[model samples]
Target: MNRPTTLREAIEAADSILIGAGAGLSAADGDHHSGPVFDARFADFRDQRGITDAYSGGFYPFPTSEERWAFWSRMISLLRYEAGPGQVYADLLGLVSERDYFIITTNVDHRFQTSGFDKEHLFYTQGDYGLLQCSVPCHDATYDNEKWVRQAVASQEGMRIPSELIPQCPRCGEEMTTNLRVDARFVQDAGWAAAAGRYEDFLERTCVDRVLYLELGVGMNTPSIIKFPFWRRVYDNPEATYACVALDASAPAEIADRSLLIRGDIAEALASARG
Candidate 1:
């Protein structure tokens, strides 16, 4: 979908637009799966394992879970919490911040907020890598991971992290785990709860407006969050327009009745939106 000729027509008629973004969107914004950082950082992992890409380096499979956590802790610090803020995320914020919009994303990188989306309007459905939660889920609290992560970086030696930040459950005094919600045990920290409330409020209020459900960079991996719900809403609301921009994007077979499928890059699509 090159810049749409009817761009103004689309937004002018749209009472509201809910932006659902994912890793794919970031890819277009200049953050791909692998780039210079991964190239250099995983040189060690590659030499030892005869592989390529930090993604593969991460899944190299160390002997112990402790070793795995150590590797991941550093990775998390670099990827999720401290990316130093890039241009792509900033441009994305510029693209949508002015509009009547709210974002729900599963990406744990925290780029949306880091680049300046209002924290109140953005909901990170997955737990952020910048936070730590109980592995056994002994309690509801999610401690600030930034401090603990920095400690790991400072104390690590010979490929092992210090025992101090072994990520134990603060409530039950068990091993602390990544705040990612991979399973039922994943803890929803206080921030997560508040974000969820805001997300619910957005849906509750926007459902009444003439919404333009903008689904960007979302794929089948987790269809429920972006694809299914948005499509359902579009189907229910005659005034709604389901505009999805993705690489080789296609909606559910049944959604053919009311959907505008734009198959292309997000930057190009946003340029179309800007038109």
Candidate 2:
């Protein structure tokens, strides 16, 4: 059978589904890190700093914490708070809603939860845009950053937010940074720990069953986290089937027969599978 037909059959026959998503998935949903969208949203930064993309802008070293927060707050608001969950996320949810499903994604946009996926069954391996932690990470905790981010986006002037608006860590009174997993200092708070445990538990319970490992838009940036592991799981579990729908989808030669690799738009592939 063709890859798409095989994928549809696997989904229909599976007892459970595990979805692994990455940056490409978000990009497919119009949440691109670099492109016209980034240029339009951050024209000022682009003009001033020659920062071409949201991802690069996030790592750009500003002269002051206030300036950094100004840029980050606006970026977060555009990508997270202001933007609605895209249809691709909703479609993915529809495909697995009736099944025992769990999502493990490297995306930090919080789109899965926003698109109505059960929070209990979703694990965001990367940190979220809505969280902030101490730069020094004096404590294993994260703070909700919506209110401050909104305030910065609203009040900043000339590419800088007021110093008073800069977020401070409650524990150590140090400047705060986004809770992204950029380094070892990334805070995995109680909530993160719980979600991690849930993901592991879900895997243990379903890995041996007739599970469909559906990988979407995952790339080699962090293959070990989701891609490589899913490949390994499908290799180990005779009943597990591996399927990937991506712009560039190809399986290893060893698991060629057991895998479905659909190279195309993920949203289109998913919609076709659902039919």
Model 1 Cα lDDT, one tens digit per residue, 1-275: 22222434555567777888877777776652477776575555456655465456555767665556666777777786656556556655666677788888977787887787899988888777788777888788877778777778777765677666577775688888777776899888778899899988888888867787777788777888877889898777766777777777776666565567777777776765565
Residue-level error in angstroms, candidate 2, position 223: 0.7
Model 2 misplaced stretches (Cα beyond 4 Å): 1-4
Highest TM-score: which candidate? 2
For 1-275, candidate 2 gives per-residue lDDT tens digits of 33325567878888899999998888888785788877888889999998999888888988888778888999999888988888788778878898898989999999888899999998898899999999998989898999898989999998899989989889889899899999999999999999999999999998789888999989998999999999999889878889998878988887787788888998787777777
Global lDDT scores for all candidate models = 0.72, 0.87
Question: In model 1, where do residues sit more than 4 Å from their true spots?
Answer: 1-9, 49-61
Instruction: Name the candidate that leads on lDDT.
Output: 2
Instruction: Give each model a TM-score.
Output: 0.87, 0.96
